[model samples]
Target chain A: MTAKQNTQNSLPQTIFRRKLPKLLLSLFRSVFLLGVGFVMLYPVLFMTSESFKTVSDTFDPTVIWIPSSFQLYNFKMAFDLMNYGQALINTVTILIPSVILQVASCLFISYGFARFKVRGINFFFGLLIFSIIVPVQSYMIPLYVNLQSMHLLNTSWQFYLQALLGTGIRSGLYIFILRQFFKNLPKELEEAAYIDGCNPFFTFLYVTMPNVKPAILTITVFSVVWYYNDYVLSGMLLNDHFPLSVTLTGVSTALNNQLQNMAGQTLGADIKLLSDAILAAACLIVVLPLISLYLVVQRYFTEGVERTGIVG
Target chain B: MAASTEQKTKNKPKRLRSLEKQQRSWGWLFLSPWLVGITLFFVLPMFQSVLYSFSKILITDNGFELESVGFKNYLYFFTESTTFGPYLTETIWQIIPSVLMILAFSTVIALVLKSNFFGRSLARAVFFFPVIIASGVVITILKDQVMMSGSSVSDMSPSYLFQAPDLVNTFSQLGIPDQLLSSITTILNQIFDLTWKSGVQILLLLAAVNNIPGSFYEVADMEGATAWEKFWKITFPTISPTMLVVITYTIIDSFTDYGNLIMQMLQDYYRNNNYAYSATIGVIYFVCILLVIGLVNLICRKFIFYASE
Candidate 1:
């Protein structure tokens, strides 16, 4: 009896020892990631659900997560009140030119830093990184005043000037990323191009630039998204024709005044009551385009990140 | 040693010297646009800002005039301002927990995402969701809702969802310690704040983890090392450089975040047309950032491991 019991117990005990911790760890990872993912997801879900709520549903505490009735009223109000179309056009104009110039200039500059070790290059590189860490707010006064003097404020020229020079919105960081990628590349390829009677410029254009196409795409996507979301500099410069971001920022306060004197409606009470829901709808309209863009390009996004020298 | 180096340089071959000269010119040619940008937009502005910080300026017809104020703007911020000291300390305090939590969460999430699992692509995209909402209108609205505190709207927003862990009320019934409860509340407060900022950090870390050579993991597997043990021995050391990068990125993000008090104050002063004081504030704020980053690098230098070159 003792021998039989020992054999049975040892078999199960060994299986348990081998499997339990591994199983637990896998379970823990899934649960932990899902929990955090849910939190990351909650705002989107909350806003969507809230945007669909009737004016009365907001007042009722029972109406959480899911609303009593689905309504397009908030969205209609948001679209008309926010002047969505004009703001989007303004955003696109600056965004396209900025992203194009930002990518092109940064590409050239980073390649130079990576390929050529000129006199004072290290000092320049240090300054580049220093600029990255320094808050733009510190330098904004002088830059802003100078730009104003140039009559660049409230014009697309301001955006173009910064981008053309490779100083547009976090361009320092972009230069750094591209430089890292360039440094890790094999020296033989550029040398071979040179040996084949290609000058350094042609070598960069043909041999080197093609090699970093994925990185260029990465920079382009980042530039687009950052330009789309930018508020600070754009707000400062484009005071007359506001972008989507600047418009959205002051939407709440603007809504309060606008709805009060709105055409043919006494939404004074209802607007106050439904302000949060309307804001939610407006947020979605602004955010949805970028979300769709992400869904389309995230594969290249991750792939590009993998190829960069952001790693050990 | 210096004389020997000078002799060696003097005796260098003609072809190599010509190549060096060619490279010097080419490098400058490639970097010309950026060099101009730095000189005009960066270095010049920086110098002017320093000068502005030291004096009073009156806007006029001919590009304004500066009058020497003898550190009055600097003195006000340093000695007289009541909020300055607290704001400075709070900014530094904010970085510690925010950076640690961001680093910890991003590392764990990136690890989990790296593994093959059900709906792994979806999970990866979901992890990057915050990066989409990081800077713009949506985050501002969300942050505003939280800042509104105690309103019904605030309670219903995502902050409430994040604050679902009302363990204080639940545990109070069982008579748990008050101090632990407050700490728990503090962590719950930071959850929404820290977690959203982890998106870019996660992206960088995932790349770092991917760049780790497969052979190390395979060797660890063959040796029967558990996942946790393998992570510490193989993964952590390998990813230390990226960890430093992530930490620096996180600290910088926090310092420049929309909610930062110093930033708010600086903007406030700028908006109020107090240019000199604002410039002074900007300079001081920049110094604080420099000191913090310098400190972080010094600390990281001791422990940051680099794979054999």
Candidate 2:
């Protein structure tokens, strides 16, 4: 396949001159993409494989790619060990409230910046950007002190407020994103609403909000993913009371301890089967929703981000 | 013209009469929640942290009193010589390669994903999922699994690429000099090896690519420009602002590693009641961040294209 005649060439010159190279190009591209795709999927695949394997099989290098026998007990064990039910509830409890507050806060803040010429507006904007740039560590000392003083330790509200408010601007990414979205809205839409005698609040909700549905959804999905997968803030605030990721850590450690007892023995079939089932069940419960959501919003997420001027 | 100006004034007064006072008052309504949250959580703590940097934590019978120590704490870090300098340097060195690799890899992957291809969206999601999942604990678990023991994150293995020995062996088999091959391998490894933890950058890059106007590319195509030319002219400028942002983000994000400033402060603050040291480090880190973000802003102002403008 000469370079000149390679059908894989996407250049304009070859478009009219050759067809074979295009076919070859597409073939090469698919293969390359599939290879990279597999690499990207490696972690999830490994986790899935580990979830189905018996306790003994998990560490065995040779048996990794395929399980000798499907054991479903691992999922059950993981579930019980992690207190999956409580953690799931706790996760939803924290995620829903936090995301709601964050959405509201972002809207109000960004709307003010976008819609009005408030005094010291530039100062406020600079403060917001500065807040984003300043690492969370900068305020951790004081925030921890303040939270302790407020006696909000181990409380769900602590997580909610920290995540929800402008306080823990750690999610400056979200704030920045919302600000950009608000700025891009046409003033004409709001002006038309004003002409019809709609107040600012009603106008924002009825006009601007409807138009930025895609941005809202994108932010909602991002907040969900961030909050659901969140362990750090949960760890910092919740102090290990059944946050989902915290529960996973707890269960993994417990399982590590249990592994020591079963070492060097081909596990008796019953125990192995039980452990495998438990692990599988836990992985399914934890990962299924996230993967499904990922698939659903995957396109919107990319498209929304691109419109926000994220990539050049 | 005079009659129209009188009509405009009359119409404007009616429009303004109902809304002027309400508008001035209601601007706070739109901004109040954020303003209150910031005042309570952001404004107070930030200034307090700055003040706390100059004071020593006293563990007297009075629980957690602060004794004003002037610039002693800051001096200890800046001039009196603590382990801070070496740790700062080590952390900075770790941040540089990690951030650079993330930028390069994300740029390449974003470019590839942006091209018309089957399963492009899936590829983007796979790459972006890591950003959402790669929190502190997740990174800790990943590090435990992948990183060699005793080498902190400073010792990065190029991600999704061959390790040094394999690359060296391949080059040697091809009759290349060991020294020459080694340097080339080193550079390539630095450039190509991304630490496999760049999900955030990938997402940001994908966003940047999506933001590039199709009209710019269409015009370039009409002008008979090459693909390379189109990228350099249209794609690069439009996305340069984001690159600055993401790069600054990656740099600052790197500093938030578990062993660095944030985690260190958390541990020391809780365990030893050392607010002064923590505050000092926090200020230093904040200043470093401000400097980096300032640089990024300066760079961005030069190249950020505003289509509306």
Candidate 3:
């Protein structure tokens, strides 16, 4: 009987020991991830919920997470006050041309750096890396003055010039990414193309460019998002015609003024409340396109980031 | 016919040399845009900024006039300025802890996200959401709203989750010094902000973790390695390069962040028509960033493992 008891106890102990730690670890992971996910997502949820809160509901302490009444009017007010349509158009006009110019120029520059043994290439590449380290703010004052003298300020030509010259917003990072991608490509394709009587340019166009599509797509998306999100450059350069980002900055004051005119009573404290709601709504609108784009191309986005080896 | 073919073969080397020269010229042709950009935008502007920093810029009828101040602005900034000292120190203090927290948080979160779990993709999307929406305008608005609501409802709010004064008090009671307590609370209070800024870092770290060869883990497992042992031996070394990159990226990102006290000060100066002084401050800040980056690179390089190609 004692021997039987010992066998039974040992069997149960082995079974429990084999499965318990794995189960506990998975449970711990889930709980930890859930907690972090909540933290990461709470702000967005707050923004969305706050955007739907009416001016009165915004200040009510009990009204948390869910609005007492769905205030769809906040979106309309924000849209009109921020001039969403015009700002969106202005942003796109600047963004599309600049994105194209930046991507094309950076691709050419990176390909040259990657494939060629040009003299002083290392020196130039070192300077390129240094430029990446130097924040735009460091040179903004001088750039502003330079642009003003060139009559380039307050015009889309400023962006076009920078993009054409491979110095647009975050262009250094893009070039770095592309160069790394190109350097890693196998030499066999270019060799084959050359043997087939293809010139270097044609070989790059046919054999090399197609292979780096994911990187190209990556740069395109990143450039577009960065340009779209840029407020400092747009604010400094284009004073009269505002992009979506710049417009969003002053949307609060604009909404405040609009609310006062409509309500006609001194909305001194209430203005803050109303404007906060409108600001939330406007913030959502500005970021809507980017979020949707990320969702659609999530796979490519992750893959592109992986390929660039920026982390590595 | 044999002699003619030999002559053709003899010409091939010369032809190839010319082709190489042509390729070199084409390379420069392709790189011309960048070259021009560097000269016009980067190099010229940087020199002009330095000159502006050392001069008193005056707006003239025709154009701006620069009267050389012989380092007066720099002198004033270093010795006489009341605002610069506080702003600089505050920014430095903020950067150090925030960078550390972001690195640790991102690495841990990346590891967790890398594991095979249900709803992993959704969790990743949730984590990456901030990279999409945490724009300057959005963050400013969010902060204001949180502060406004936080003052009213001290508890039972998400903003309160970040406000851990009680935790700080408890730590203080446990013999933690006042200075350390305040710093701890400051970090705690800005936990949300730090987490928001960590979106890209997390993505980068996650990619780095995923790139680690599974064979390393399999071998470790076959040798009866503990999870902790495997992490240190296999995961850490493989991802050290990425850690350096993330750390550098984080430092730069944090320094140049738009929503910061120093940026606000610079903006104030710019708005107040202190162009020369603003340039001086900007240059100084840039130098500080360079020093910090150099320091980090120096320290991290010692531990960085480069797999031999």
Name the candidate that leads on DockQ: 1
Model 1, backbone clash pairs (residues 3+ apart or across chains), number: 0
The better candidate by lDDT, 2 or 3, is 3
DockQ measured for candidate 1 = 0.51
Fnat values, candidates in order: 0.52, 0.41, 0.45
For each candidate, the DockQ is 0.51, 0.33, 0.39
| C-alpha lDDT values of all predictions | 0.80, 0.66, 0.80
Interface RMSD of each: 2.9, 5.7, 3.7
Docking class of 2: acceptable
DockQ of prediction 3:
0.39
Better of 2 and 3 by TM-score: 3
Which scores higher on TM-score, 1 or 2?
1
lDDT rank order: 1, 3, 2
Per-residue lDDT tens digits of candidate 2, residues A1-312?
Answer: 686565456576555557667788778877876766665666556556656765555444457457778876666666677777788888888778888887766776678876676667778777777676565655666776788889987788786776666544355666666666566555776778888999998988878787666567666776777777766556666665666777765554576567557754845534433343344445455766677877887776777665543222
Candidate that would win on TM-score: 1
In candidate 3, stretches whose alpha carbon ends up further than 4 angstroms from where it belongs are: A1-11, A111-122, A177-218, A266-269, A303-312, B1-30, B145-158, B169-177, B213-226, B305-309
Separate clash counts for every candidate? 0, 34, 0
Error of 1 at B263 (Å): 0.9
Q: lDDT for model 3, please.
A: 0.80
